[model samples]
Target: MNDNHSSSAWSTYSRTVFIAFAMIALGLIANEHRVHVLGILPWLLILACPLMHLFMHHGHGGHSGHSGHDHASHQAGPVQPKKEADDV
Candidate 1:
């Protein structure tokens, strides 16, 4: 395999492993102690980052409604023949 491909693959693998470890650590910490007023909000934010990123970046941009208006103008308004059948 090319070096670029190998490097990208390794990077993706490392990112996945890092996220997994973070989630596991969060779960362990949350489970071991009683919920606290200060920790609650921050923990929620930490858990929500992935979902917020998914929606803000990946989810909304995939919809084509924003570009559909451009397509409407390109369509032929109506078919018109140069000469009527009676003219032939």
Candidate 2:
């Protein structure tokens, strides 16, 4: 393992880590100011709902309703052999 190569590889991620921490700090600060934040909460919720709907539920939304498997004709119970006593 080369020391310089490992350092250079990880150095590329330094900015991403910094940005992630900055966003977390900003969220914490926003959380501290709940009175002001509450006013914007409604709009954020409205905006987030559709974004979540579109992004999170894409698995169900994008696919055609038909998967290859048929559901209706699936057997639910065990098949019992005709009992000898039932015919009477």
Candidate 3:
């Protein structure tokens, strides 16, 4: 039982050490690539605009599927309110 406990403790300790080293390595890599990443940030943002518009409009059923709206009906005349008897 003690041996099993020791093995489990060793595994957890090794895993912790590995994760710490991995984080340090990632930090170093990110620091090294910071300039390149920043240079691409603008292009990434520009690309994101069309992607966001496509995805966001998809969630709202898009512009092509307007079921009840009639475009031609709105073109005929300016809307005038009915004259009430009290107004005259």
Candidate 4:
């Protein structure tokens, strides 16, 4: 029931934290061999940049409200509004 679901969520969270820490530890070990790593660093970055740009920005998503218009240079020069955000 509720207890089972709560325990399951906690277990998943704990496992995720454990894996994150393990990765940090592995990264530190790799950093110790940074001299060897740096030799391929530039090549890795050159390859990754294009791949990430292509994959990550593949989808143009639901910003349908945006008309792709540049209304910055309107007939009415400028209008500054009051602060609308409520205090937290």
Best candidate according to TM-score: 3
RMSD in Å for all candidates: 12.1, 8.8, 7.8, 13.0
Q: Tens-digit lDDT track for model 1 on 1-88?
A: 5655554645877989999999999988877775575668888899899988877775343356556444543465977778757765
**What does candidate 3's lDDT look like per residue over 20-86, in tens digits?**
9999999999999999999999999999999998778764432467666656654469879998788
Number of clashing residue pairs, candidate 4? 0
Score each candidate by Cα lDDT. 0.71, 0.74, 0.80, 0.77
Candidate achieving higher lDDT, 1 or 4: 4
The residue pairs that clash in candidate 3, if any, are none
Q: Record all residue pairs in model 2 with backbone atoms less than 3 Å apart, i.e. clashing.
A: none
- Per-residue lDDT over 3-68 for candidate 4, one digit per residue giving the tens place of the 0 to 100 score: 555546457779899999999999999989989888998999999999998789755444356466
Query: By TM-score, is 2 or 3 better?
Result: 3
Model 4 lDDT, full chain set: 0.77
Residues 1-88, model 2: lDDT tens digits: 5655554645657879989999999999988997887989899999998899878975542255646644443434666788677665
The runs of at least 3 residues in candidate 4 whose Cα sits more than 4 Å from the true structure, single-residue gaps closed, are 1-32, 61-88
Question: How many collisions between residues are there in candidate 1?
Answer: 0
Alpha-carbon error at 56 in model 1, in Å? 28
Cα-based lDDT at residue 52, candidate 3: 93
